[model samples]
Target: MPLPHRVSDLSAFDLLLSVAELGSIGAAARAHAITQPTASARLSGLERGLGIALLDRTARGSRLTRDGALVADWARTAVGAAAALDVGITSLRRTRESRVPVAASLTVAEYLLPHWLAALRPSAEGASVALTTGNSDDVAAAVLAGEARLGFVEGPDVPAGLTAATVGRDTLTVIVRPGHRWARRRSGITADELAATALVSRERGSGTRRALERALRRGTDRPLEEPLLELSSTTAIKAAVAEGVGPAVLSSLAVAAELAAGTLIRVPVVALDLTRELRVVHPAGQALTGTPRTLAAIARRSASLDDPAG
Candidate 1:
């Protein structure tokens, strides 16, 4: 007799988890660098393996069934453990590489630092860089705990034991899918309109969320309505918006592809500039003028956000 159900595989699990965070099959596949049909197939197979439905699909997008949400959280824990194992293996390689670890908040990690690190490779003096990504608060904690030597944050506040320097700026854009009503034109919209609708956004303590709240309050009433969907990752927020979950405010630097492909439309807000400076911060009284210096140099050289076409 054949098996009643196969044990969960990594791809299926990851896809399900991604879909749960991401809210759409196409968006989930894109997150993992796969195609939509392939993601759909993997998810379907996983549903069969479990003999239960995982997603609650609708015209708006996908949501996890209560069971799926619980399973996704469990799967994420398992995947994180697997990653820790891989990291442990790398540590046992007995290599002579330098152990300089860099922690960056999600915005910097997704938009800026990768380019900087790529260009910085030539000057690394054979040192290897280990990157850890988290929220601004979490990145600061990582650095304070000695897990990373440097951090990048986008907001104005400075962490204790850290000195910050302005590196660049990222402007936030109110965005929605091409099919969204606001995307029909380029004229500025009123804050009252936004306050009346469903808003999908990042969760608390996110630099983007803080910045957005400040910007919104500049024109709207005090303490706007709660978000329709609140997520932790920029990519996840984008996915939700793409599936017509609701309109969102996001960094222009983060949505280059969607803007270029016409998948997302940028709406205008008059006198409502939503720009924030990106900063590099590290331990105070310490000159980051060494290998980190070279890394920063490389980051500036390869900063892809400056030139999105490349």
Candidate 2:
């Protein structure tokens, strides 16, 4: 089947995106090592092809008009799709390739994976890694659907169709506003008290929720306080907790800065290991013992995941 346009034609799409981001055609052109005339002509050609005016070329510089911003959005999407396709094709040509496709739950993906990927040099694996971020369940789905070769889940048990290994550990700390009553109560706070008070929480399928469930199950049958607000990201949960909304149980990694700066205070929660082991899960049919093995080893080696509760 014929593609909508040749891949090279998307250079104009990329030019539009770069100009939007850089906020000037000359600056964007220089970023791509192209002359001003070439950039201007490229933008004009793209606008002509798409049958719309995409930019307001100014004497000082260029800026996106109303239509330009909309075109910029589509062009950005096209550029990303083009890049993904390019990487996929390049990996195919490699004899012993390591196109380390991964889908990881939010915490691991947002806070940790980039560091791990940077630590992995092209010398050893001679492979490339591409990451997709999602919640625990979505990460599992991506792996099961063959969209990712490996999955890292932070929330719950590994979903079926994938075998998992304990690669690392994360600490879930109890935290509240710096001036909260729990601030004086160091790491051994009781679940009875935790249950009595309102706390911010993640949605049902969060890995944090799974760990919290296990912790609560072992404690007194007292109905713990329901969530004051259910949020998705650790950032949101911590922000709410800091605002005196409620105390929350969250990854120490999530609140390290706040704890250090006194934006939030770490309250002592005892007897329960709020720590969860992070695992690398992959499909049963695919022999994933290759890149994940190397990637996991690198992750473990450089990981600075030593939480006090862990």
Q: What is the number of backbone collisions in each predicted candidate, taken in the order shown?
A: 1, 4
lDDT of each: 0.77, 0.80
* lDDT by residue for model 1 (111-148), tens: 77767777677777667888998777777778777787
Highest lDDT among the candidates is held by which one?
A: 2
lDDT string, candidate 2, 132-161, tens digits? 887788888999998887888886587778
Give candidate 1 misplaced runs (Cα > 4 Å).
1-97, 195-197, 300-310
How much is 84 displaced in model 1, in angstroms? Answer: 34
In candidate 2, list every pair of residues with a backbone clash: 155-207, 186-268, 187-268, 187-269
Candidate RMSDs in Å, in order, are: 26.5, 18.2
